[model samples]
Target: METGFPWGSAPSVDLSLWRADAIVLFDWLMSTDLNAVPITHPAQKQALADLLARLEEVGITESTEEEIAAPRKMWQGHGLGGAPIDQSSVTRAQGSMTQDIT
Candidate 1:
């Protein structure tokens, strides 16, 4: 649906979906940080919950503290809340300079 906000303005949305659709949605989400937001659809929330559960099952949810710390330092140094930025907030300004989606 066309977002009614002004041209180039943030979109407002609401939606729902099933498990398979939720998987794809969450996969997109894992690429972002949860703190940032114009707000993802509610389906995105359910999808993320599901994805986290799957990660727990696969053992990827458990990370070595040291391993996690290295990236944390790098992200802070780069001036991101941590690299991946915030999931809900699209770092559009960052993108204008970096040309990287993440």
Candidate 2:
């Protein structure tokens, strides 16, 4: 469906983006932020939820600390609320750039 806000001036949305990624359409979803105005259609809501669940299950966007930290010989003894991430891995993931979606 073509979409625009009531105030006008915003560009129309091409919802073909839903098919862009079998994994996750981070490109069109504002880098996977999903901060847009709600799509009120029930089917749209359900589809979105299903897609999110699939992504989380496969660990693409949702992964345990071990999956992330242990892969690179960066595991240190527990500290700072975590196993003290190595400076190398620390650089890969900054605090402000990460989010806990699960």
Candidate 3:
């Protein structure tokens, strides 16, 4: 088995050696270390763009300009205030009786 660079080894020029090397590239991308290695190949960039276009066709793409906005229903009076409570008050009055005790 051949060993690659150290923990922070620089990027290799060979793309054929990349399946394993790409992992290191991903680590760099996550750490905001843009200078370590360049993974900006033309083919990779095109592939990513194609994937994003397909996702947009299914409405999964995130874009601020063409966002789907819907009117939010106001729930201010969706509870008892929106319902009729007069019948309940009448029923309570009819169920009660005045009792006298000496």
Candidate 4:
């Protein structure tokens, strides 16, 4: 399976996100204090800034209340509340699985 990116051939890749998610992400990123974060390289900071600028250019900076609320409702409905997963069951299930070694 060729899962990894072909970095040698591809110079840049496009990113696609739901409009509501993109708006929320942009708002969060805008409110974050980059100075407090321990970013060593200047390019990293510039890259983040560039992302924000692109978002702004695409009208992600301004969103309607419905747009913002829709994603929150969708997430809540899907049970993605940022809760930590219960790993005990996962470990047990993994242990029970038979490995087919060729």
Each candidate structure's TM-score, on Cα atoms with residue i matched to residue i, is: 0.37, 0.28, 0.23, 0.54
**Model 3 lDDT per residue over 1-102, tens place:** 122434554443312221112232333334453343446675665444443333344333332321212101222233456754365643453344321111
- Cα lDDT of model 1 by residue, 1-102, tens digit: 333333565543444333232333434456667656345596665555555555444444354555445334434634335345553333432233221110
Better of 2 and 4 by lDDT: 4
Residue pairs in collision within model 1? 32-87, 33-86, 33-87, 36-88, 36-89, 37-88, 37-89
**Candidate 4 lDDT, 1-102, residue by residue in tens:** 122333544244467665655776777778888776578897788667767777787777577878667556545533356655456643543344321211
The numbered model that scores best in lDDT is 4
Candidate lDDT (C-alpha), each: 0.43, 0.43, 0.34, 0.61
TM-score of structure candidate 4: 0.54
> Which rank order by TM-score, best down to worst?
4, 1, 2, 3
Q: Count the backbone clashes (under 3 Å) in each candidate.
A: 7, 0, 0, 0
| Root-mean-square deviation per candidate | 13.5, 12.1, 26.6, 12.1
The candidate maximizing TM-score is 4
What root-mean-square deviation over C-alphas does model 2 reach? 12.1
lDDT of 2 by residue, 21-42 (tens): 3223332332454446487776
Which has the higher lDDT value, candidate number 1 or candidate number 4?
A: 4
Least accurate 10 contiguous residues by lDDT in model 4:
93-102
Q: Candidate 3, residue 73: CA error in Å? A: 26
Off by over 4 Å in 3: 1-37, 62-102
User: Which candidate model has the greater TM-score, 1 or 4?
Assistant: 4
